[model samples]
Target chain A: MNIPTLSELTARGETPEILFWVGCAGSYDDRYKRVTRAFAKILIAAEIKFAVLGPEESCTGDPARRAGNEFLFQMQAMNNIQILNGYGVKKIVTACPHCFNTLKNEYPELGGHYEVIHHSEFLQQLINEGRIKLTDTTAYKGKKITYHDSCYLGRANGVYEAPRAVIEALDADLAEMKRSKTRGLCCGAGGAQMFKDAEKGNKEINIERTEEALNTGAQTIAVACPFCMTMMTDGVKAKEKEQQIKVKDLAELIAEAQGLA
Target chain B: MIQQILFLLTLLGFAIILRKRIVQISRTIRLGRDVKIDGPTSRRFRNMLLVAFGQKKMFSRFIPAFFHFLIYIGFLVINIEALEFIIDGLAGTHRIFAPYLGGFYTVLMNVFEFLAVAVLVACVVFLIRRNVLKLPRFWSAEMTAWPRLDANIILITEIVLMLAILKMNAADQILQHREPQHYPSTGKLMFSSILIPVLEGYSTSFLIFVERFAWWFHIIGILAFAVYITYSKHLHIFMAFPNTWFARLQPAGYISNMPVVTREVKSMLGLPIEEPGTNEPPGRFGAKDVNDLPWTSLMAAYACTECGRCTSECPANITGKKLSPRKIMMDTRDRLEEVGRNLQNGGNGLDDGKSLLDHYITREEINACTSCNACVEACPVLINPLEIILELRRYVVMEESGAPASWNAMFQNLETNFAPWKFSAADRFNWAKD
Candidate 1:
């Protein structure tokens, strides 16, 4: 039972409770949910009454579509559209880029459309609006961390700064990947790749991406995409940097600054 | 004497045919990518001079490259010698016009003849390498159905070209004004016998007669080969320049925007939701027909040299996933041919056209691709597989409704959970360890 559906929001006169479309990466990866929840709390404490999706929130048909299961993808897309329309939720927020992309881009195929923003952009907006206060000093105030732009978030949707802004806002030392922004290398997680194996290539994309971050001498690895965070975390562990470095999402970084974590 | 000139004119016709074919192929390959421009201005210019006129890309493989260089330079330099010999025959007299052309031209022609010999030797070695030694790696290129025939034609053409180049020297040696009747005895091939030793004790008249006879043979051979090459897969000589030049401009990540699916001609706006147009719309969002494909899709067939580089790097193919990168091009070619064949009988392809996804490619094959872009990268021609596959997926997801079982559940979960899995949407930030 999802109370935050688009229809219910419109019925309740909250024309935009800010429908949060949590992606499967965020759903299964509990760490990301914390980030979203923290972002959500900003809206909540602001009395914005942000509507968080529940049981009705599922996978963005992207994985299905990438898997060539277009029928199932459209069904999911159509179902989600109906869910959004029923709730009359015009604006949606997401921590996962894949969800943001699928809903914002792929949903029209199934006839569902809405105003969608990446959590970074929404948070940046909130920060700009002065709804959320942050300490100029963060846990990683002097620590160097590199931010990996997720393919879906940065390349597909062009949401580069919001996450970086969050990191910079936290007053953390930031580094860059060689192939950042438009040329950002895939984290071996696009087009259903996270669910599959690395095909023939020089390096596993996560490791390759991790190596880029590592090359920046960033001790802490930060990412917005759940897949990127997980993949980078795994890459760090494999490189035996588990003891030397740490991985954190933007939400967690913001939360840390506020002493919430 | 007049027969020699007629023969040279016949050869010129052949070169004209070849030139026409190469141009057509160039145009066809230009159609494949979505706005591919080769390097920067200087780079394109340099590449055009080097790759197109200079034959630079061929040098990537040394043996073949070496031979091809010789043949190419050989013809360019000695082409006038063959032409002049034809004119001499037509004039019904033989004067040493080649020497009168200028000392530099005479020396350059001599050097070109020697290089032509090198080219001949190189071609033979390459042919042996490909056919007798059976370099299995080249099987992809060799197995290109029509390409194999083209290869044979190229081999014959090269042999003839070499004969022509060698004969230019031969005709000069055998048919000059001093020794016009020595054609039978002065038949020496520059490719086979080194000119230094063969010129020993040879009379000047014999040399001129040989040169004249060889000149006629050379012109006919070069022309015939050119015409044949136009319709062949080796059409890359003309096609590769533009194909490599107009590689994709953007990073591989840019997915082309899907067309607006609207009912009316106008009224489309950002955040497409309803039919904003004045006319009725189908409300569907994916390409439904060949007409729906980006023009790039059609261009793929021409850009494809059937090199199999794409198939070689394809993970799906290596994993036995049924998708062959070469076969994709072949399939495209087959469809185009079918369409053309049907059109010849006064039928539009619409009635005969079938969905390639369901016909040539199975659902399993489509699902098997990881979309890694290895095929895209490995392709010497740089055919972007990611875009093609995604478009196919769009058709599947939006138009066809075909999908795997687990994939279906994933989509269902996406709708229900606002994600792709069975988890709640609230737990996204639970894993922060820093």
Candidate 2:
């Protein structure tokens, strides 16, 4: 896979249509790295000339802001915004809702104005435009799959349908947990909770959320955000249901249906 | 004549106590950082009306909300009777509004009497809920003897005040029938009418004395309760309006950017930074103590009813986390009061040798928050305990550099690699490379 950086494209006197914000989790987390690969394969199949930030990208300082380190958050945001503004980057697509939310909503006020899109929305757009198609006899077809709503993506930004639309594109059976939409429970890893230990609680939030997903009897738990991907995966492991139930990102399911990954 | 003298003296005493307490509260609130609360007036007023006056959020739970509404309406409507009581006390008159209001007076008194009994019942039910039933939310780690006792005292005070009003009406009814010298035929108090039949067998002089004693006790109790409420969570009765008025009108999930940090970022990014030359102190990044919080945040602390709705909904608290949003507000109020007392005792403000950060709210509690804004949403009076939690976390990160090791590693990665990973930033797109 030949992925061009924004800097390289600019140096070549060319510009891509969109900048792929490969967030830290997608860049480094082993599990989420698969999500990144799956999403990139889908993007390539869609024939969208998207460029990655590569070394120019940094953590969106989402954790800093949530953790109340404003100085640090501003420092990081300023650095990334300056780089984006330098490239005249007009649009951004990220796999992490934390980055999608911060870049789309919070950054404009901080002088970083760009059209930000989460990969789930991007995948749905691809499917809607007929750029990517899924086969009827795909591996996940008719499989019981439940989508877990990430707090930042669902309640924070109200991006519920796009992810589910992408999931439906897989021709899979979509079963929803009781707490699916606005009332969806957190997967024990948001608002900088991913960085710290669970603060001496009776039951971890991810475990509670996982139990909800499992109760739906879905063989596959579909997620859109990398943070939720990490947390829900950990939850599945805790339940020791790795073999029984598989936690997969929507992008991964799509890629499998398309024979891309 | 002597009675008039005693009434005036009592009025003066109440004025003194009320003034002293008001000064202390205002001073403590003023200690917080200055913030621009003046904006979007229409929206603010709408929130104040809905949350404070309408008690809109409280209705999410029906049973308790209905009972609470009774007391709330009673407290507001019955204050009309206090106005007449004040006028009668000042002029040494008996039922001053009785003649002017006529039949309307009877109807008004009847409503007030009915609400008085309703308030008494509601207060009794609340007391039972807190002490006897022991609702899980009210029995958290931070809700020790003082908060529990504070709630009980407020309820007990309301109950006694309601009973005094009823007893006074019952005794006054007897005195009026007996054609006493000063006792006037105001009207029948509806709910308190039951007490008249019971008191009918008593002597006329004893009835007059009972009426006078109950009257004095009710007014005095109200005055004392007013002053004492400033020191209690019951201050929400008054502060809720302003707290809700100054509430955050933005999307619940959006936290505002700090101006001080914005300028510094602008400077770093080669953007046009604002030129600053003012007598204002240097901007502190986050709160180190209670004074570092915004005035509205301090008001929120005072307005907290210690209901623990925030904690109960908190993902961390449900999982048995040490962090309780209710505890954060309670600790803030407690620390603010401590500072006020210290200042009152002739101690320097700088050397209280303690602060809300380490002394009251711990590192464990602030770090545990997921910043989900659930606590903020659950708050009936619009108290954003998350703001306090965030401010304290800021202090830990920026000032003390006291975050856990994993956090420090993440911070370093963010600084060096622009991500929360140890890999080179150039490797970010490796996922796209198969």
Candidate 3:
């Protein structure tokens, strides 16, 4: 992946148009790595000069903050803000709402100010600008696809239209769940709940949320946030319908439609 | 003169009980750490009107909302009758306002009668909903015997109190017809007039006794209810106003970073840290006890109606997690009350050694929360359980170093690698490669 680093770009006295924040899930989670690759490919295809923080990028400290580790969250956030300021980064695009939300909303208080855009919004913008073209014979054409709203992306930040617009650009039939948009249920990986063992309950939240998605009868469940992708994918597997129902990130769906994957 | 002396004693008793309860509650609320809650005055008033008086959030569900509205309006309007009762009791007079206002007083009594009936009906329906219908949220693991009994007792108390008013009116109407000198004929009481016929055959003395007994019972019950409510979820009747007024005006999802912790980080980073006069060695990172939380949060605890609206909407509770937002509030209130009692016994602050975190609320319940803010959004009175949960989690992580293994690893990755992964941050952009 010949992705340029801000440090490298700064060393060469060059600046990318946008900084690509490959969040922990994008950079590490095996399933979400494809989402990272797919989004990167879209950026390359659109001829957008973007650079990653590379080794300089750290966790947005969202989980730490949510888990109530204020000291750790501040520690991590301060380090990232210093590095971001050092590189003179202005605008950021990331594949995770957890990162997008923190960097955009939280870091400014700690003196890290930048225009952070979630990948869904960024993809919608690219499509609107006519930078990328979708052709016929696409896998998603006329297929029933349902998008799961990540809590951070949907209710937490109200970025509902962009992801749906990006999915609509694929010419796929979007199936709306009973609980969608503002009423969307969590994929169960939000807050710091992703890291802790779920308390005793009659059902796992992911299973219930996945049930809502499957009830839509969509062949493919689309997710914008990497966390949602992981959760929904687990949900699909739990229901033993992995072969029938495919869980893919919106970027992957776009990558497939544009033949960038 | 004897009647006036007895009434004064009753009034004095009520005042003393009310004063003691107010002092206790104010002391408990004072136990919380100070967090300035200044905001636009207009916005605060608007929130109180909308959430508290308007019952805006309750309307999300039609049936319960209707019943709740009836009870709430009934509770407020019936207080008018209480005012009249207090005046008549103090002056040793019967129907003092009746002759002054004439027909308007009759109309006022009718309206009060109508509201009392509505409130009675609403309380019965509420009792059924809690006990007979067994709403799942109400029956959660947290809704132990005391909470259930407390709710039932409140409803039953209101029912008896309303009946006492009607009985008193019925007996008084009969006495007025027989002996107009002693008991003035106050025209006709709407609901109680029907009961007049039921008590007509009794002797004039017996009728007066029944009227007097019912009147005294009604007033005493009112006084007792006032004090009992402080110990019950009914505290929300009063706390909702202040709780709604002090609610966070910001978006539900916006989490506030601690300024004290922020300063420590800036200092570590060699940034110009603003030192605000070293206050008790930077005082613990997050809330380990009730004293560590913001005063509004403690007020929220005291204000919880235990309606379980937050738990009903909670994703964690729905998913079978141990977390119940209602329980969090209940635990907080319980701990505050305990601390208040400890202080009354001459215990010196949090030095009595009991704390809110372990003694009242468990780490398991707090950990199960997903921080979705559904609980906060679901609460009609604007109580933020997430705030309390987050503070406790902070204590676990910062003070006890008791985070789960996976979380600790992620923390290590965040510290050393700048990401929540063991792989180097240098490989972050590798996803861009084919």
* Top-scoring candidate (lDDT): 3
Q: What lDDT score is found at residue A101 in candidate 1?
A: 77
Ranking the candidates on lDDT from highest down gives: 3, 2, 1
Docking class of 3: medium
lDDT tens string, model 2, B1-434?
67778888998999999999999998999999888765689999999999999999888678889999999999999898999888888888988887788788888889999999999999999988988899998888988998889999999999999999999998887887788567656677677789988999999888878988998999899999999999899999999998999997755556667877787677766778765436576656688898889988998999999888788877788788888999999999999989899888888763678989888888888888877666776788999988888888887887778887778887887788877767888777677665
- Interface RMSD, model 3, angstroms: 1.7
Q: Name the candidate that leads on TM-score.
A: 3
Tell me the TM-score of model 1: 0.59
List per-prediction Cα lDDT, in the order shown.
0.61, 0.85, 0.86
Q: What are the DockQ scores of the candidates, in order?
A: 0.14, 0.55, 0.59
Per-residue lDDT of A1-261 in model 3, one digit per residue for the tens? 688888898899999999999889888788898888888888999999999887667788998899777888888888889899988889999989998889987899888999999999999999999997876436888999999988888767878899999989988899999877866788888887777667778898999999999999999999988878878989999999999999998888888888877
Better of 1 and 3 by lDDT: 3
Candidate 3 chain A weakest ten by summed lDDT = A132-141
Q: Give one digit per residue, the lDDT tens place, for model 3 in B290-378.
A: 98998889999988989898988788888877889999999999888888988898877677778889888888888788777778767
